[model samples]
Target: MRLSRSFLPTLKENPAEAQITSHRLMLRAGLIRQTSAGIYAWLPAGLKVLRNIANIVRAEQDAIGAQEMLMPTLQSSELWKRSGRYDAYGPEMLRIRDRHERDLLYGPTNEEMVTDLFGQVVKSYRELPQVLYHVQWKFRDEVRPRFGVMRGREFYMKDAYSFDVDYDAAVDSYRRMMLAYLRTFQRLGVKAIPMVADTGPIGGELSHEFLVLAPTGESGVFFDGAFEEQDWLSEAVDISDRESLAKFFARMTSFYAATDEKHDEAQWAKVPPERRREGRGIEVGHIFHFGRKYTESMDISVSGPDGAPLYPEMGSYGIGVSRLVAAIIEASHDEQGIIWPQSVAPFAAVIINLKNGDAQCDEICERLYAAAPEHLLYDDRGERAGVKFADADLMGHPWQVIVGPRGAKAGIVEVKNRASGERSEMPVDAVLAHIGVGA
Candidate 1:
């Protein structure tokens, strides 16, 4: 993508309304533009990053045997009513009325709707274990929606529901999901630890909220540093093997981790004093087993092996897809701009033509673009070298391959690592090799 032809309307100064680092950088970087109090129109650059994040979430969900399907943003209120939560969900639920005067809502969550979907199908124990997920926009009318996408009223979310015939089977499914979460966060280049969350009514130690640590986060978090040393991807844990899943889950949960709400002073002391660590964090994902809360409330029953009605044990897992964009920036940015992790970066590297019209500079950039156009963003705009450099750093492409007249004439480029602020001058092909692009 050529910056000269792109729609990245980056701001030289930060927006006054953006009070947080993620919010300010997102505005300055032109990732998102606020249309209303909390609503945003994701610009070209923002949409790409958002999609990249969503794809990663999708892949990990698929890895855990969860099937993907699309669900409606505007859900029928009737489903909520059947579960007796239509009135109880409170103001966060964006209630509305259609032409027929039927009460409706822009779904805050999909538990009721998904439960209804499950009840309509899966009539027997043979269909006992199933997982369904969807990535879609959701709305919650936050009384004070601030902090940009981090606390937006409208956001993209991935919610998955699991159905099982019994409590034991449901717990096994939860462990598998937890393993998936750990692996997903690792790939996304963030340190996320699952903390015990408040399971309101149906409870027995089956709730967890995955919090990504950041300096400016809202919630206080305490966890063992052992979480940082484990490599989830390299662990030989098979999802289908219940024993493997149990061991993996135990390793993660055994660490003393808790958010402010569930913080236990006695438990904190129990953790080895040397391993105790604390920080503020943003909630990125959460998974909880609700047993038969929804299935029983909605009277969703399937025939058991003994031919009697059995309410399926249920759980809901959520990842704030849009919120993650802000969260990643929150956790990774420096004074200059956002330092995007390569996996979720919009483009792997940006080739900055320091002198756009210069034949040598243009030739090298165009050649680099032609070699790996999909992974490269060519800064073809007629701007100053400083402007290009600042913008490149602001957008946080993992690498910046600079083509100046001096290096261009010599058929070489200066490759700058965005994260490290390290620079090395090398041949064009060597630059490509360093960034892992085939020439």
Candidate 2:
């Protein structure tokens, strides 16, 4: 993508309303714009990052055999009524009325709707174990929506529903999702710790919220320091093997981890003094096993082997796809701007034409741009060298390749690593090679 022709409306100063670093940086970097109190319009650069994060989440979900599907943003309130939550889910639910005066709502979550769908078509135990997921927009009317997209009223989410015949089978499905979530966050360059959490309106005894530690977080969390060192990605997991799944579950749950709501002082005392860790964290993902909660309410039943009618056990998993953008920035940014991980970076490398109109610089930048990877963004805008450099840093591309008059004359370019702030002058071909795009 060429910056000169792109719709990146970067700001010269921070927006006064943005209270957090991620929110402020997102505005200054031209990633998003607030259309309302908590609703945002993602610009070109921000949309690219959003899509990248969505793809990673999709891939990880697929790895665990979860089939992807799309669900509607608006749902019939009748479905929630059937589940007895139409009235229970108050203010946060965006209630509305259609022409016929029927109650409708922009779904905050999809438990009741998915349960109704499952009850209609799935009647036999043969379809007992199925994981279905969708990436869609959701709306919740937050009384005080602030901190940019981090706590937005309208945001994108990846929600999955799992159906099983019984409690044991449902637990296995939950374990699979836990593992998938861990791997997903790891690939995105964040260490998310799974802590027992309140089910809230979802209503279940078993629930976990994955929190990423960040100084700007809203929730206080306590956990064993060992959680910081554990590598969930290295462990082998067999989703279909119940014994293996149980072992993994035991290993992870054995740790002392809980959010403030669930934290116990007695439990903290049990751990060695050096292993205790208390800090602020951002909630990025949540999962719950609500056995028969939705299925029974919605009449989602399957025939057992003994030919008895039984309600299917179910669980729901959610990841805040849009909120992750803010979370990533919150956890990784420096004074300059965001430090995006390569997996979720909008652009892998940025090509800066330091001397925009200079013939030699233009020739080198154009050549590199032609050979650059599809993920690279070429900054050929007619801006000063300092401005171009600052923009490149603010955008937080993993690498920056600067083509200036002096460097072009010597057949060299300055290659800089955004995260390390390290730079070295190399032959133009070498710079291309360093970016993994050989000339």
What clash count goes with each model?
0, 0
Cα lDDT listed for each candidate:
0.89, 0.90
TM-score against truth, every candidate:
0.97, 0.97
Per-residue CA lDDT of candidate 2, range 126-172, in tens? 87798989999999999999999999999999999999988999999
Cα error, residue 78 of model 1, in Å, equals 1.0
**lDDT for residue 333 in candidate 1, whole number 0-100:** 87
**Cα error of candidate 1 at position 394, Å:** 0.9
Q: Which 10 consecutive positions of candidate 2 have the poorest summed lDDT?
A: 430-439
Candidate 1, 223-322: lDDT as tens digits: 8888778675687888888898888888777778899889999999988989999989999998989888888888999999999999999888999999
lDDT of 2 at 77: 91
The C-alpha local distance difference test score for the whole of candidate 2 amounts to 0.90
lDDT, candidate 1, at 383: 84
**Candidate 1 Cα deviation (angstroms), residue 148:** 0.1
